[model samples]
Target: MSLLSMTKTNLKALFHGPYTSQFPLKAREPFANTRGHIDCDLSTCIFCTLCDKKCPTGAISVTRSVKATDTTPEKKGTWSIEPLKCIQCGYCVETCNKNSLIMKGECSEPATENVR
Candidate 1:
């Protein structure tokens, strides 16, 4: 081996840069239109309940006549998501008519259970 090359390799190994995150302790900034989870905007939602029908995991529920504000017409609905149950199949994202649901594309680690 060349004398100069051996010195370069050893120097590079000593200066390892910052790599991974300190996640699960600190929250990261949300990326542009990041799909953390699909939530419903009750004000604009038309009570179509289309998302409820399309969700494969039954994560979303749509309820009409929920009174959030008197000024708004009570065109209410709900979106509930259980991350553990989600298959990440992208069905709900495709079916949303009002762009209420979207895919952020940042994949989350699958949660694991501890057996006693």
Candidate 2:
């Protein structure tokens, strides 16, 4: 577009206000099928390592460690998902048999930590 046309367009947009809502004041809801963020319930989770295996980006981490004091046959692990690398593909959710992993409507906000 020409400079004059661009200027006119910008002026119109400024006077009429933005077409979208101002962020932080009004946020749009996620779509019904949108895969936003992943959450895990540790108590319900069996630490099967299925989510870690299913994650395409390798964002999910499942670490299993045996405690000497605990005499459980099954080893337990902590689950963590790195938001920066996650693609929100919902692969982990589909793989989780225990229903401990869930995809929430709200995604992770912008962050400076571990940002590549």
Candidate 3:
């Protein structure tokens, strides 16, 4: 009886094809609320450190560059994230007042380095 049941299960599995999709050939769709990764739009960013402060893992870094001139000073900023350290909690996206931060549905690509 046990041998018969095992044979039946093996035959069913053989005819069922693969249970999982081919990952590289056909990527699976991300879920609606998936916390994939954080993306930043530098054009609209105001150099605010809210995202950096809000990051629970301290993965975000915001640097402000100020160039002093005779008349006035020009302010520029750079935003960088350490993908390995990021927890993808979406806190940085919510804390951004300038709407520069976006939560991308696609997962971050495999990286050889920690900084991105």
Candidate 4:
């Protein structure tokens, strides 16, 4: 390609604007049905392990921790998820026996100090 054509293409594309929203200044919203992050309500979970089993990435770890009680020591649900490993699949949320898990459409931008 010629130098002129290459320069024009690059300059035009930059001036055309980005496909994403303005950072920090704008509060961007995800699509109405966009699935982003997977979070679960710890209180509603029954330690069924259904969600853990259904997770394809094995990102969800359901640990049974002892609840604080004077009378007896009972197992309570402790759900943990690794954000880096999650594939954003809704299978865990769908297979949950309790309607505890929720898919939050959180932004995927990394924390950067670059002002430009």
Candidate 5:
């Protein structure tokens, strides 16, 4: 009786197709309010270092230029984030006064080395 039941179940599953989707070919949608990676908009950013200070894990780093001259009008500063160290807490995004920091819904890609 047990063997018959097992066979019936196996046959049903065989014709039913796979329960899971092909992950690589088709990715799942992100959940509602998913805390993903942080992104910075350099154009609007003032490099105020507020995001760096608010980061709990010290994932954000801001390097501001010493001085802005007329000749070097575009010399603002460098803003970078260590994706490996980020905890996706969203504090950095909230602390950004210029609204330069953005929390993207898509997750960060896999990386063997630390990405800036």
Candidate 6:
């Protein structure tokens, strides 16, 4: 483009201000098939640890506790996910056999300075 055209375009952009909406007040709708956050339903979960194993970032942690007398370990314990580390890839949701994991449209909250 010529220098005159470039100058005109720059002036137009400067007068239009930002094209984006005010984020907090007017949130944009997520695109179709967009993966945002991962949520797990512990009730249907068998503690199979598939989600933990399939997660690329090691963001998921599945732990099962067993009693001293029990021969088989109970399908229950801690299931924690680090939102900051997760990539929102939906791999865990696909790997879950019980369909207990879901990819929600809402994204994870931004990490604060106090987060560990």
Q: Pick the candidate with the highest TM-score.
A: 3
Give stretches of model 3 more than 4 Å off: 1-10, 66-75, 114-116
Instruction: List all candidate RMSDs to the true structure.
Output: 6.0, 4.9, 4.0, 6.6, 3.9, 4.1
- Candidate 6 global CA lDDT score: 0.83
| Pairs of residues clashing in candidate 3 | none
Model 3 Cα lDDT, one tens digit per residue, 1-116: 36576888789999999989998999999998888888998878877788888889999999876653322223476789999899898988888998999998889998777556
Task: List model 6 lDDT by residue over 1-116, tens digit each.
Answer: 56576888789989999888989999899986878888988777777788899999999999866644533424356688998899998889989999999898888777685767
Clashing pairs in 4: none
lDDT score of model 1? 0.64
Worst 10 residues of 3 by lDDT: 66-75
TM-score of each: 0.53, 0.70, 0.76, 0.65, 0.75, 0.72
RMSD value for candidate 6: 4.1
Which portions of model 4 miss their true places by more than 4 Å? 1-20, 65-75, 108-116
- Clash count for each candidate, listed in order shown: 1, 0, 0, 0, 0, 0
Candidate 5 off by > 4 Å: 1-16, 70-74, 114-116
Q: How well is each residue in 1-116 modelled by candidate 1, as lDDT tens digits?
A: 56586887677767865455668776577777555555555556676678778878786676665565634534344455666666657787787787766666465555555434
- The order of the candidates by TM-score, greatest first, is 3, 5, 6, 2, 4, 1
| Range of the 10 consecutive residues with the lowest summed lDDT in candidate 2 | 66-75
Candidates 1 and 3 compared: the better one by lDDT is 3
Off by over 4 Å in 1: 1-11, 22-34, 65-79, 87-89, 102-116
Q: Report the C-alpha lDDT of model 2 over 3-115, residue by residue, as the tens digit.
A: 58688778888899679888789988888877888899887887779899888999999977666564342446678888888998888989999999988888778767866
**What is candidate 5's TM-score against the reference?**
0.75
